[model samples]
Every structure is written in structure tokens, then in C-alpha cells.
Target: MNLDPPISSSEVTLERLDPLSAAAARPVTTGAALLALVLPPLTLLSRGHEVTQPLWLIVSYAALGGAAWLLLDRSRSTRPVWTAPSAQVFQVLLMVMLVTAAAATAGANDLVRDDWAPLVVGVLLVASTPYRPAREILFWTIVHTLLCAALGVIQAPSAITDVPALTLAVTGSFSIAVMGFAAAAYARSLTSSTQLWHDRAWQSAAAAALEHRSGVARSVQQRRVSLLNREVVPYLQRVVNADGIGDDDREEARRLARSIRTLLVSDVEKTWAQLMLDDLVGRHPRLNITAVADDPDDLGRRAVLERRTLLRALAAISVERLSATGLALRLSTPEGRLAVRWEVATPRPLPDAHRELRSMLELIRGLTLRSSVHELPGRLVIEFEYGY
Candidate 1:
């Protein structure tokens, strides 16, 4: 009876999704890296002859930070994630750079006040927040803070300072705390919100999928009962009430069994697309996305099964970020290439939808085309040809 609606599916999470990934934050990393390159040289330039071992300090601190920035940024793009081991190594390198800057100073400048290493290292920590967890960032921040304080204390004893070494310690590394803790807090809050959304959305989607499958089974069973009631069940009852079964009854039973068999076989022969639609319909409990396959020219073996993951990613992002009312995708080959038309419906216009999708668009550049964002009130229609 419920032949009108089919189903669809989507999957997206903030951590790995292109929106919030380390790769997407390359500009931030690059800016921090640039600052590292500039700050130490500026310290030497400003202090003129007062700063000690200019070549040594700038080379060690600025060079290390710049190299770390390059390495971390590249890793994010090349891999699924910047591994925790790699991040740990990178943070260790940062602390070593700070210690080197302090040693190279030789107490000519206040190791705490005049050194560029502490401030740049703090910026680097903020940049690393995208790649590393909050706990790890905070832990490393504490480590860096202590290291700065120790350097300041060692320098304080030999020099003329009105402030106590402990007080100097707090002043010297306080910026690191402010910057690193702030970045860690941001990462923590974002992670929690994303995790909560991911959990709730998946839970609701799973429940919807289960309900849809159960409904389909019940529908099939109801149809079977309807068929059996017409002649097969009544005929069996009469035969039981009568003395012996006749040739006519035997023929009728065989015909009924054949009809049921044919029906089941036909049901089994449906295309992959139809089956996918059936399973995916009502899967998103949020909007209850109902799929209706308009594949009059049906040739379905996933219609480019390699692109299923892409579709899933796009769908997930659309729902999570765009507040999508519904999602529709069409996969077809035109001019010997796969043509995809993806449409997301929202209750209101998302002016920055394209901007939000910048990273994902890059991932599938071949499938992006300029279209009606301003003109379309409640829909985003993306039509493109994808060769890869």
C-alpha cells in the first residue's frame, strides 16, 4: 500500500569533516608560521647590540617553529589525521626550541622578557589545537610554562632583578597560559558540541532505519496474507471438512503456490537503487527524508559505487550545517563522464552555504559548478560532471 516513498542516508562528523579538519586551518597555521619567522629577527633588530647570539637564537627558535608548521600542515592534507605520536614529537620540538633560545641568550637580554621564543611558541600551540586534543595541548602548555619559569629562575640569580625568581616565573610564561589555555578551551567546546550532534543524529537515524525495515517486512507479509485469503486458505479448509481431495483441488493448490513464488521472485529482482531508497527512507528522524526514485531510465549498480562515500559525506554535512529539510542526489553518465545533481532543501536560505562547503568542494572540484544561491529561496542545486 505504501509504494510512494523510498529512503536515503547521509553521514558527517565535525572532527573529520572538511569543515573543521586540520587541513582546513592551513591559513591559520601559515600565519603563525610567518609570525615565527618575523618575531625573532625583529627582537635582534630592535635590541640592536643588547641581544646576544642573534644568529644562534633566531636560527634555532624561528627555524624549528617554521619547520614544525610546514610538517604539521602537510601531514593534515596527506593523511586522514595528524597522528598523536607526530603531534607529541612536534610539541617536544617546540619546548626544545624555547630552551635553545634561552641558552643562546647568555643572560644579555631577560630570557623571559626579551626572548621571541615564548610568544611565538604560544602561537604555535594555538595552531596545533586543530591537530592535537585539548588535554594534550594543555599538558604541553604546562610543560612549556614550567620550562620558561626554570629558564627565567636560572637567569634571575646571576642578574640584577627586583622581582623574585618565582614572580619572574609567573610573568615570563603567563602569555603561554593565556594563549594555550584559550585555544584548548576552544577545541574542547567545539569537540563536545560536535560529538553531541554526531551522537544524537546517528541514534535518531539508526532508529528510523530499523523502523523502515520492519515496516517493509510487515507490508510484504500483509500482501502474502491477502493473496492466500482469496482462494488458498479457504480451499484448504473445505478440503479438510470434506472426505478426500479431488484433482481440481490439487490443480488449484499448485497454481496458488506458483503465483506466490513468482511474486517473491519479482520482489527479489529489484534494482540496487530501489533497495537503497527503501532502506534509507525515513532514516533521518529529524526531517524524515522520504525518497522517491525518478529513475525511469534505470541502470543501478550503485550508479558509480565508488562515489557512495562522497555522497554520504556531503549529505551528512548538509544536514548538520545547513539545517537541510531534505537531500536528493542523481547519478548519471553524460558525455562518457558521471554527471551528479545534488540538491539540498532548507526551510530558509543559507547565504554562506558555499563558503561553509569550501573544503568539501575542493575535495570534489570536478563536481562543482556555479549555481543559484541568491535566486533560490529554499534550495541549493549543484549540477556537475565528475570524471574522477
Candidate 2:
């Protein structure tokens, strides 16, 4: 899958959750499909308590569930497969199911009334399927709290048992209030999870961006290396040949060519150094060499110098195409006073086939740690006091 920004608020919908939405959506549809089973029994039990009472009610439940399932099922196959907006709708439906069940239970003269069957089925649906349908699990969670609020309001008249004004609302209002609190807690959890996902997505995007830049930089450096190797060096050799004719002159020309070659090497090294520094600055803009060191301690200065040298070396080695995924370099002070450190990244969960790579990184880390430096995939650090 191609990395994109993240799921924003606008894209939070059932339509977004398409395919797996059906996994959850199926229950709702099935509930509606099976509503036919519920209505007949409820109608018989109600025994004519108004003409279309249980008939319309059961049909409505089935129809609502079925319609929602069908619409949601058709929209399956979107990237996320579940959106925040779709979750809200699912949460609302669950609350309705719960409240309707409670109401039917409360109104029933007999505890085992046949009408209670549908409510039982409804509770099973609520408990088993989801509080929220798809990725909108959290969004639905928020809506569940809203439903609880509504339920509490509906049950308000039952608050005072002895008061004629408050009959059906007493116990249920308190129950709904408690359910609301639970829903609120759940909503908070969902919020945290969603935020975490977005954070990860952004982090991945940043890594991808850096990787792209690294690839481009590596390509440019390789081209420069090729030009130096194939063209510049040969041109310098020709210059040496033209000047050198007699034996004495030939010796002088060879010496001059050698000096020119050394100069060329130094120039190429400096160019590579600049490229590495540029890449480092791009990756971590906050690294302030000035603020970090005012009066220069030997150890601090050496560490900075070693890092700079390693970065340059890595840039130079990146002239090889396939070997440029990432790099690590071990460095210690010239006096050997400080611990050694290295930076590295590879196909994490390092493959068994790459025993050499595994050995190299492990050896580097172990040796560095022996001197009190720690290095890992994302960061590296070294401390001078090794014994502690």
C-alpha cells in the first residue's frame, strides 16, 4: 500500500470503510433480515394492542438493519475500510436497540413475555457485533455516550418512585447515567488509539520523504564519482604524458601526476563531506554544533569531527548503487579517550541470510557499548565514563 497522509475528519464515513464494514455490517443486515421472525411472535403476544403495533415495529427494526447493511456493504473496499462517520451511525443504532429492549422489558407484565424475544436478540446483536461498526470504533464510542445521554433523559420521569410525575424514569435514568460514564471512558480510549495511528502515519511519511532525498543524493554523488574516475583522472594522466618525454622529464612528470592525484583525492573527499553534512542537516535541522559546544572540550570536539568524517565516508561509499540503503560508521577519538559509536539501519528483523550484516552491526554495538556508547536504528549516543 502507498503511504498517504492520514485519515482526516472529512473522510470518516461508512463509505470509506467498505469491505470489512460488511463483516460488522452483516450482523445489522441479518438482524433486519430476521426481523420477519420477530414481528409475528411479537404481534401474537401483544394480542391486538392497536392494529399495526408489533407488526410495524418489528418490520421497522428489520428494515432499518437490512437497509443499513446493504448500503454499507456496497461501499466496501475503501483504503481504511471503516471511517469515523460510519461508526457514529452504528453507535446510534446500538443505543436504539438497547433502549428498546429495556423499554419492552420494563413494560411487560410477565417476566418471560414472548415480546421480549426480539429484545433478547437485539441485546445479543449489541453485545456481539460492535459498539461501533468499523474503523469508526472510537467515533461510534462517542455517539454511544450521546445515546446514553438520550436514554438518561428518556428515563428521567422514573427518578422519583413515589412521585406520580416520575414513574418509568427512576431506575433506568440512573442505569443510563452509569452506562453513559462507561461510554465516555470508551470514547477516550478510541480517541487515544486514533491519535496514535495518525502519529504513526505522519512518522512513516517523514521516513519515506527522507528515504527519497537520500536516494536522489546518492545518485548525484555516484555520477560525480564516475566523472572523477573515468574522465578527470584520465585527462590528468594525458597531461602528465604530454609534458614527460626524456628520462629526467618523465620522472618529474610521474611525481607531478602523483601529487595531482593526491590533490584530486582530497578534493573529492571534501565534496563527499559536504554532501553528507547537507543530508544530515536535512534529516535533523535542530542539530546545533555551535550551541552544543562553546569552548571545546577535547572529547566533544573529537566526537563532532568523527561524526563528520564518517558521514563523508558514507557519502563516498554510496557511489555503489545497491549498498546505499543506510550506513553506519564506528569512530573513536584520536587519543582513544572516548567510547566508540556507530549509526546503522537495515531491513529490520535482520535476515539470517545476511549473517555478515548481522555480525557487523552486533559487533559494532557490543564494542561501542563496552566503551559506553549506545547505537540503534533511529539514534546513536556515546558517553565517556565507561565503567558506570
Candidate 3:
């Protein structure tokens, strides 16, 4: 019989959260895309300038809109391939091309003209902040800087001569790229820190549980040793000294043997629920316990483990608050659903008891498919339905 507790669902969720995956990255990607989509139209509108080729402006808007949709749609899927570096690179290149085409159609000589094309490109680059790694972000940032510089020089060859305007365009684009990279790095760091704290908490809990179980085992072993010394040891010593067994000695030996047998069989093949009830009865003789269950031997390993964990938690709560006069536990498989119902009545209200045993209750709920807790006057009832 395994006495170790099963891993709770909360632990599994925490474990999954620790690893950086597509699901974790989706929110940032989606947010960045939405921001980029909104900024371009707002930038174009704020500038209030007519383009030389209205068709090119329309095409650019359509391209940006399509890119945003692609990103938002892909983020909804959990597949890693959709968020791969290659996919991100392709999206970035598409954005750059569409922005450049728009700029070219606006007339390169009028690049320094009151147009938000450069700013739109900058925003597009920033949109990659959450999805790409630092090295990749750096590479793209440099790429955008060069693209902006080239566009400024092409729009006005004389702007190259006018270093101020040229410098402004290049520096502005570079700054936006750097800011995006910084934001992405900060976000990654925050996620890592959160996962680290979760892992530490789980480790601390596991260590505490281990120490508790070890202490319980040690205490039980000490009691067993004391029992043997008081009964079996003395009986054996007398038989050894006398060299022959008399009627009193025989009776004493038989009694000692029965005691040893009872001790050995105490918990050998009992279910966890049965063992818990026995312990509860021993501790609180006045408390009445009625239990009904399917044969534990018929249950699968996982079902048994889950049942044990649930019963152990319930037993602990009941034993600590001996206000209950009656405790009833029922376990059955009705219509192929494994169900458990526990009812307890106490002299006073246990309104705060659920809060005190919140963790245990959470573990029980996590193990089962569905469960409910009801507080009625002096009685608390909990029901759980689960599967193997």
C-alpha cells in the first residue's frame, strides 16, 4: 500500500506555467499586433495629408490589417510552429515591404514632407516586441534603422546634405526599436521571476509534507517498539528462563501471539478511508461513524490514491474539530460515476471550517470531476463525483 499523497491539480498547473510556451507568449503577441493596427490608421489620420497615390495608401492599410488578423488568429492556436522565429521574421519582412511600397508611391523626394509613413514603419517594428527574442529583436532593429536611413536619403538626396532631418529620421526609428526590445526583455524577465516563485512555493510545501509524514512514521514506530517490550519481550524472556512451558506460560504465550497478530494486521490491507475512520473512532469514542463503500480492492490505482487523499484530508478536519456527533461517509459507483458523499453534524456552526481547510478542499476538488460543499445549520456536507 502506497501512503504517499497524489500530486494535486494545482501543482500540475503551476508546473505548466513555469515553462515558457506558445500559450504563454500568445497574449503579448496579440496585444502588440492590436496596438500596431490601431497606431497606423491613427497616425495617417492625425497627419491629415493626401498621398500622391491613394491606391498605395489603401494597399498599405490592407496589408497592415491583414498582418494584424493573421497574428491575432494564430495567437489563438496553441501550436508552436505558428509562433516560430521564422514565422515572425516573415511577418516583419511583409510589414517592411508594405510600408516601403507606400513610401515609394508617396514620392521619395517628399519623404521629409508631413507624412506618418516612417512612424507607421516604426510602429510595425515595435509590434514584434513580445514575440521575438532579444537577439532577433536587435537584428530587426538594426534592419529598420538602415531601412529608415535609406528611405530618408532616397526621398531627398538633398536631405542627406541636410544632416539634421536625416539624423532625426534614423535616430527616431532606432529609439523606437530599442524601446520595443527593452519592453520585450522586461516582460520575459517578469515571467521568469513569477515561475521561479511558484516553483519555490511548491518545493517548500513538498518539504513540509515530507517532514510531517516522517515524524508520524517515527512516532508510530516508537509506540510499536514500546508495545513489544511490554508484552512479547517479557513473555519470551520468561519462556527462555524457565526452559519448560507450564499452563500459565502457555496461556501467556497464546495471548502474546494474538496481540502481535492484531498489531501486524492493524493496517495491512485496509483502505485509507477505513483506516481513517478507525483512527477517528479510537480518538473520539463518543462520535458515531457510519461508512458505506464499494470494495476498495476493485478500484484502480489512481482511484485509490485519489480516494485516500480525499479521505485523509476529511479525517484531519473531523478529528481536529470534535464537535461533530455523527459522521457518515458513502462511496459508490452509480451509473458508472465514482461518487463520494460525506455528512457531519456538530453542536455549533462550522462556517469558518471551509476557510481553514481551503487547501485540502481545493485538492479534493481538483482530484474530482465535480464537487460541491453545503453548509446547513449544524451540518456540513460534501459531495464528489470523479472517474478512474
Top candidate by lDDT: 1
**Best of the two (1, 2) by lDDT:** 1
Worst 10 residues of 1 by lDDT: 1-10
> Which pairs of residues collide in candidate 3?
108-155
Pick by lDDT: 1 or 3, better one = 1
Find the number of clashing residue pairs for candidate 3.
Answer: 1
TM-score, cand. 2 = 0.35
What lDDT is obtained when candidate 2 is compared to the true structure? 0.39
lDDT of 1 at 325: 65
Candidate 2 lDDT over 118-177, as tens digits, reads 333333233322223323333444444444445444534533223332323332333333
On residues 1-20, what C-alpha lDDT tens digit does candidate 3 reach at each position?
32224434322321123323
Candidate 2 ranges with C-alpha deviation above 4 Å: 1-52, 67-167, 170-181, 193-216, 239-388
Model 3 whole-model lDDT (C-alpha atoms): 0.55
**Model 3 segments beyond 4 Å from truth?**
1-32, 46-50, 77-82, 86-132, 158-165, 168-172, 188-192, 195-199, 202-388
